[model samples]
Target: MKVALLYNQKPDLPENTPKYQSDEFAEWDNPETIDAVANALRERCDVVKIDCNPAYLQQIITTLLEEKPDICFNITEGIGEPSREAQIPALLDMMRLRYTASDPATLCLALDKARTKEILSYYQIPTPHFRVIHSLSEGMVFLNEHHQFPLIVKPLHEGSSKGIFERSVVYSVEELSRQLREVIEQYKQPALVEQFLSGREFTVALIGNGETLEVLPIIELLFDHLPKDSRKIYSYEAKWLWDDPENPVEVFKCPAPISKELADEIASLCKRAFRALRCRDWARIDVRLNEHGKPFIIEINPLPGILPNPDEHSCFPLAARTAGIDFNALINRVLDEALKRYNLAI
Candidate 1:
């Protein structure tokens, strides 16, 4: 069997670009992660790495056509367009190629937080009340009406906490307006203003499909070590800059110390969200509890981040590790689940 590992290789920044802008654009897979995935698959099948950058897309298509791998382990987060994540899958569908993870439509739907929330709400799944703001002026109406003050604003079509910062959680209209404009100008997209859930926040990872789907252990975000004034969000800085392996801050607690009842409820909600979004193979769902201990779906990551380093604070791998699944086993498990979906597993 042959497996093609597809991933985004972030290109080098222009020399004249500012540091902050360059840092923001560096959201692609690092070499270590690509190598780790390749190494994992090398033990089970013939593996080749394919770059998913738009510039080299033709080369990728040609390579796949010639090689004809049995399956593609797709983790290609496209660089441009709102439906970037779905672009590669759509191409694969055009070429009649089998790939891992959710389908193109699900990937496109999951990328838009508002649309995901709409589907969740349609299925009667719990999610926070949110408003999509295209401009800063619309934020005034959101604040004036029957809305809450403590709202968290984010780019409607971004993941990996790209547009989310420490100031995302706003307490006043001024802050909301500022953050809303920032998201609009910086991300060039609508802002998702969600009613903040103050209760505990947790991330749930699941693998497989349908009746055989397995929900791994839950991971809770710890904010005790953050600055006194910092909000309890897993902001971009906290995710990428702050949490170091050697000088860790204990940012995540796996198998979050919760009662059986709450744990079951969270797992159920995660599974429901996964199915409702039509996710396949594996996914990571973020959830937060309300003041009354009711869990609400925050967002779904079908193509979850898999940073290779053990100390890199990647939630999906951490949850798997806590469940007694190592990196290699977890990688193969995802591949095996995809193979099962296509009836290609022997």
Candidate 2:
């Protein structure tokens, strides 16, 4: 089997890079992660690495055409456009190639958090009420209509906690306005203002499709273990800065010490969200409970991160590990699922 590992490698920025731009590549996979995925695929197939950097789009396409691998293991969190993550998949589709994860349409839909919420709403799935604010004036109008305090603001088209900070949770109109401006102006995207849920947060990872879709162990984010002054939500700092391999923050609890009934409910809710989004192969769905203890879909990540390091606290791999699937096994399993979907022998 020949497998093309499609990925965007994080660029090494200069030390003088601006603070705001430091996390510009947060969504892109590190070389360590890229190599890990390639190595895993190499175990069972002939692996070819293809960097999906937009700067070299022509070169990338030429390489793909030349290699013509049987399948592509896409993890390219593309650049620029709002539908960036779908770029590689769209290209693969144009090439009539089979790949892992969701289709281009689903990837594009999931990237826009507001659109995902609307689709979830249409399906009668529980998600927080949110409004997409394109400008400060529009945000003010939303704030006037919805007087919900303690709302969370985020970039409508970001993942991996990009542009999310502790200050994202606004308790006052002033805070909300500031965040809305930052997300709109700095991130160059619409701001998603959502009613903040104050309860336990959990992330669920799922694999396969339809009735065969298997939910891995649920992971509960222990915000209580965060710094004293930090907010309960999983901010970018909490994910990358505060937590590291040397001194890991005791944050996630796999298999989530919850009642079987509650676990079943969360699992079922996640499955519904996955199917609604038309996710394929594998995905990670974030869920947070309301003050009343009701779980609501936070967001759906069809292309979930798979940081090989156990200390990194990546939710998807952590959940898979708890379910007895190691890093390499998990990678191959996803490929196998994709193959099965394409009716190709593994």
Q: Best candidate, lDDT-wise?
A: 2
Q: Give the CA lDDT, 0 to 100, for residue 3 in model 1.
A: 93
RMSD of each: 2.1, 1.7
Candidate 1, residues 211-261, lDDT tens digits: the string is 999999999989887778778788887776666556778888998999999
Question: How high is the CA lDDT of each candidate model?
Answer: 0.88, 0.91
What's the residue-level lDDT of 125 in candidate 2?
94
How does candidate 2 score on lDDT?
0.91
lDDT digits (tens) for residues 1-346 of candidate 2: 9999999998888877743465667788889999999999989999999999999999989998999999999999998787888999999999988899999999999999999999999999999998889887887787667567889999998887888999999999889989999999998889998999999999999999978999999999998767899889989887767766677667999989999999999999999999999999999999999999999999999999899998777888899899999999999999999999999976
Candidate 2, residue 287: lDDT: 96
TM-score of 1: 0.95
Return the TM-score for each candidate structure: 0.95, 0.95
lDDT of 2 at 318: 93
Best TM-score among the predictions, by candidate number: 2
* Count of backbone collisions in candidate 2: 0
